[model samples]
Target: MLTLLTGLAFGLSLIVAIGAQNTFVIQQGVRGEHVGAVVAVCIASDVLLIGVGVAGAGALVAAAPGLLTVLRLAGAAFLLGYGALALRRAWRPGALRADPSGAAVPLASVVATAAALTWLNPHVYLDTVVLLGSVAAAHGADRWWFGAGAALGSVVWFTVLGRGARLLRPVFARPGAWRVLDGLVALVMVVLAVQLVVRPVGGA
Candidate 1:
């Protein structure tokens, strides 16, 4: 029971961070787009990564410096691309809308974008792979319970963040609020993208 609670605490602490992935999830929720698919992908990806980490995939990944390098570069490119889009929207007057605008994008595109946001980010690897793995392994024989608890936290967080985002519809109905949110998201993505390119893992 202690192990499970510990895992839940750790997982919630990490997931609550305002990262690119969470930002995207909130945006989808606000737009009333394919929120279900995004939430599912985020939860499933977290579970898979945390499970693999508990299974010792983290150690294997640490051994392969090359793999981290490739992921770092790819993630940086994706972040930069997304950041540029956000930046354009942020600076372009009349871009922010109080309501959903334009036709809904294809579900395939939404899933692909969500997957890229999940898989490509090295921070996800760092969190689930290195951090969560180390935390769960500390439980020794009870590591699986810890992992399950952590996975539950992830499920709960994404569900709330995605589904509960609609609650913010009233606040986000203001165009200025959206501009602020997008501006913040763009800044975070661009800064993180720059950092990844400049100081990649293993100093690659």
Candidate 2:
């Protein structure tokens, strides 16, 4: 029980942050396209990372300072690039159109986007596999329990965010709403990327 609760708390803390993945999930949800598949990918990625962490991979990661530094640099670059693309999209003049009921995005495209957003970001591995794993390892024999709890948190949060975005589709369908939201998302990503670049050593 303690392990479960601890994992849940830790997972939520890390996953609840605003980032590219969350932004994409929410946007897809509001568009009423491929929400389920996107959510599935997000959850699956979390499961894989959390499992790695619980299996003591965190220790290996901790021992490899150079690898982690490289990952951080790579992640920052990817985030900045993504942010620029999003910003361009936001600036491009386009009217918001409601997706027809039952309309869905292409499965392959959704999967590819989800995979890129989840796996390409080095921060994901560092947070879920290294950071969370270390926490679980501290629990020793109960690491599996912590991982279970973290998995539960991931499923719950992604489900809620994805489904909840659909509920806001009506509001998002208005002229300029999507532009504003996407623009803000771009801004957020830029800020995060800049922070990562300028952050002091030993600080996240």
Summing lDDT over every window of 10 consecutive residues in candidate 1, give the lowest-scoring window.
95-104
**Per-residue lDDT of model 2, residues 180-200, tens digit only:** 877887898788777667872
Best by TM-score: 1
Best by lDDT: 1
Residue 146 deviation, candidate 2, in Å?
Answer: 1.0
* Error at 119, model 2, angstroms: 2.1
lDDT of 1: 0.86
* TM-scores, all models, native as reference: 0.91, 0.87
Prediction 2 global C-alpha lDDT: 0.81
| Per-prediction backbone clash count | 0, 0
